[model samples]
Target: MTINDIKNLLNATVVSGHQLLDTEVHNACGSDMMSDVLAFVKDQSVLLTGLVNSQVVRTAEMMDMVCIIFVRGKEPSEEIINLAADRGIVLMKTSLRMFPACGILYQAGLRG
Candidate 1:
């Protein structure tokens, strides 16, 4: 699936990287713990997280995720947004909770 489809599925608001909305995403993992995310690095995928820190972007970069969906309406700081922007990772915010966000994406065909 593409970032655009994910946005529609989750009713997410793109916080950055609008130009990357069409990027392809094949897998997804949801976690708020950066260490746990680091433990499970695979191919290009999407990350669903409620963490609102720059470390989330850093971890996503290390894991090579194409996009990050911040659930629970959590917003990252300016530094975090800049970090994600520099890494070319699309960042979005959603009102849905973490479990529901992950479920919606998985149900829409994003998996790991």
Candidate 2:
């Protein structure tokens, strides 16, 4: 699904890269641990996390992820948003917790 679709599915607010909302993401990974994400995730385009740090954006960039969804209503600082924006990554915030956010996307046909 597109990042726009995921935003609609999760009722997320776009924090950055709004112009790229139409970007397609076939898989997702939900985690707050950058180490776990770096060690295990593969071929995922979207990251759902509660962590709101620059490191999160770095991890997503390194993993070639196109989007990051901050769960539990966590909002990233301007630094983090700028970093993702610089990397051309979409950033979104949602009130839903990690599990439900992931589930909603998965149920909508996004895998992993």
Candidate 3:
């Protein structure tokens, strides 16, 4: 699925990277622990996370994720947004919880 597909699937709001909303995505992993996301995620283009910190962006960068979704209405700080913007990562927010967000994207045909 594309980033735009995810946004449509979850009714997410773009926090940054408006131009990148059309980027494609293959897989998704949801976690609050940056360490777990870093240690295990592979070939995942989208990260559905509750952690709203710069480390989240950094971890997604390390894992080569194309987008980071803040679930349950979480928001990233300016520092996190800057980090993501610099890394060419798209940032989005959704009111959906992590599991449902992942499910929505998965049901929409995203796979790792």
Candidate 4:
């Protein structure tokens, strides 16, 4: 699914990268641990996470993740958003928690 599809599926609001809504996403990785993400994620374009920090953006950068979906209604700090914006990474937030958010995307055909 494309990022737009995920947005619609999750009822997410874009925090950044509005111009990148059309970007396609083949897979996603959901985690609160950056170490796990770095250790296991492969070719995943989207990250569904609750950890809101500069390191989240940094981790996405390292993993080449195109977007981050903040679950559980969590919001990324201004610094985090600005960091993602600088890297051309998309950031979004959803009211759904991690598991259900991942499920919604998976049900919509995104895999990892």
lDDT (Cα, tens digit) per residue for candidate 4, span 35-106 = 999999898989999999999999999999999999999989899989999999999999999989998888
Model 4: lDDT to the true structure? 0.94
* lDDT value for model 2: 0.95
Backbone collision count in every prediction?
0, 0, 0, 0
For 1-112, candidate 3 gives per-residue lDDT tens digits of 6798888889999999989987877778889998787778788888898889888888888888889999999978889888889999999999999888888777888874
Ranked candidates (TM-score, high to low) = 2, 4, 1, 3
TM-score of each: 0.95, 0.99, 0.95, 0.98
Model 3 segments more than 4 A misplaced: none
Badly placed stretches (over 4 Å) of model 1 are none
Of models 2 and 3, which has the larger TM-score? Answer: 2
Better of 1 and 4 by lDDT: 4
Candidate 2 lDDT, 1-112, residue by residue in tens: 7999999999999999999999988999999999999999999999999998999999999999999999999979989988899999999999999999999999999999
Root mean square deviation (Cα) for candidate 3? 1.0
Candidate with better lDDT, 1 vs 3: 1
Candidate 3 has an lDDT of 0.87
Error (Å) of candidate 3 at residue 16 is: 0.5
Q: What is the TM-score (0 to 1) of candidate 1?
A: 0.95
lDDT for every model?
0.89, 0.95, 0.87, 0.94
Q: Which is the better candidate, 1 or 2, if ranked by TM-score?
A: 2
